[model samples]
Target: MAYLRWVLGRLTAAALTMTGVSVLIFAAVRAMPGRYSDLVLGPLATTADKAEAARRFGLGGSLPEQYGHWLLNAVQGDFGISMASRTPVSAEFAARLPVTLTLTGLALALTVLVGIPLGVYTGTRGKGGGRTGRLLGSLGLSVPEFVLGSLVVFLFTRYSLGLTVGEYVPWSQDPVRSALSLLLPACVLAVFCVAAVARTTRDAVLGVLVEPHIAAAVARGASVAFIVRHHVLRNASIPVLTLTATLSAYLLGGAVIVERLFNAPGLGSFLVDGLDRRDYAVVQTGVLLAAAVFITTNLLIDLVCGLVDPRISALAGKARS
Candidate 1:
């Protein structure tokens, strides 16, 4: 019953968060300098053309009314047509979302697979690994996504790697080729993910190692591997889980920069394209979708964390009371 209540509360919170995000995005889209009409119709367009274009866009009413209309249509899955592409915004995003998802998924998988173990190992090794981890973490954190991407491009091009070029390949046509092409970009995206997770995991693990129970186990002559497997990892994971959830937001932003740098046909590039062309429908929809994704992801992470640690549930229960 407690868990059920917790889930319901989280769901409610998610809905409200998304509603607020929609309002903010709506306002932001409206606040941009150039009119959608001006972009669609050329600069030479007359006032009559602009007025007609604005009417067609449902920009006929006050700000609140415009937002309400857009929100109503949006809830009904109607994002309207893109001014630049003349195609339905939904169709355009549906085509591009998968590419971004795949890229982010690949990067996240690598981060978890590589970062957690590295952190665990460093945590176990005491001072030496801690120092090394800190050094590497700093290096990883220092390099921004685009800079790393540019470096990758330079190295690959200068050395004639012949593995990838600045173009996207459809997975349907060549799955292996597509995967290979995205590898470098995914790696670039994963840099911060890896650094963040690894550092957090190291800290979490080290903290767990020093806990009274962990000290008791050590005093009892428990094997290092046994202690780590049975206790340390289970306890250390709570903070690491939180870090992973937080970094997921960064991953979304990084995907945009990396996609543009790599010329990948992902939603990131789609959003950039929409912004460049002043495609209001496309840009607003993309931002809202990204916001939705972040909210949903954080909600799931919260649920998982609650499942993994009873203390979180206890804290929530106490807070509610």
Candidate 2:
């Protein structure tokens, strides 16, 4: 019952969050200088051409009326036409989404493979390990993705090693080359996140190690492996899980620069192209989708946390009451 209530509450909140995000995206895009119609029809276009472009882009109506129309159609999964591409925004978005998803997936896989273990080792071991993890984390966070990607590409070409860039092949066409194409970008995307995850894990594990329950388990003839596995890891994982979800969203944002840097035609590049051309529908769709991904990831993370720790669900219910 509590879980069901929690789920309902989360769904309500998610709906509200997405609504607010959509409003912000709509307003922010419209608020930009210059006119969408002017951009689409060009300055040399006649008054009638501009008027037609305006009407087609839904810029002929007041902002609120336009928003209402767009929102209504959006709820029905009709995102309208792209002012720049002259194609259905949904179709273009659907086409571009997979490339970003594959890149994000590869990045996340790399992050988890590297971050969690380093964090665990640092947390459980001595100060040396902790310091090392922190150092690596700081360095990773400090470097910009563009610089990292550039340097990596340079070094790879110099040495004839590492993932290839400047050519992206969809898996449907050539799986091996497609996978190879994304690897470099994914690694670049995962670099700082790896550091962050390690630091978060280290802190979380250290926090759990000092709990009274941990000491109790230790003193109660618990095996080292048993205490570490049951008490240390399980308790420490909630924070790690939360960080992972947060990083997923952050990685989505990072995909833009990584994609652009490596010539990968993902949503990030799509958004860039939209902005350059003032393609309102494309911009709105891209940002709104990113917001949705973030909201959904967080909600799912909360639910998973509740399942992992009943106390979380109980606390949520009590708070609601």
Q: Model 1, which residues run further than 4 Å from truth? A: none
Write one digit per residue (lDDT tens) for candidate 1, span 1-321: 777788889999999999999999988887888877767898899999888877876677798998898899999999978888778999998888778877888899999999999999999998999999999899988988878899898998789777675777888889778788888899999988898888999999999888899989999999999999999998998888888877777777778888988889888878887887778788889999888878988899899998998778778877897
Name the top lDDT candidate: 2
lDDT of 2 by residue, 97-120 (tens): 889999999999999999998888
The parts of candidate 2 lying over 4 Å away from their true place are 220-223
lDDT (Cα atoms) of all candidates against the true structure: 0.86, 0.89
Q: Cα RMSDs of all predictions?
A: 1.5, 1.5
Q: Estimate each model's TM-score.
A: 0.95, 0.95
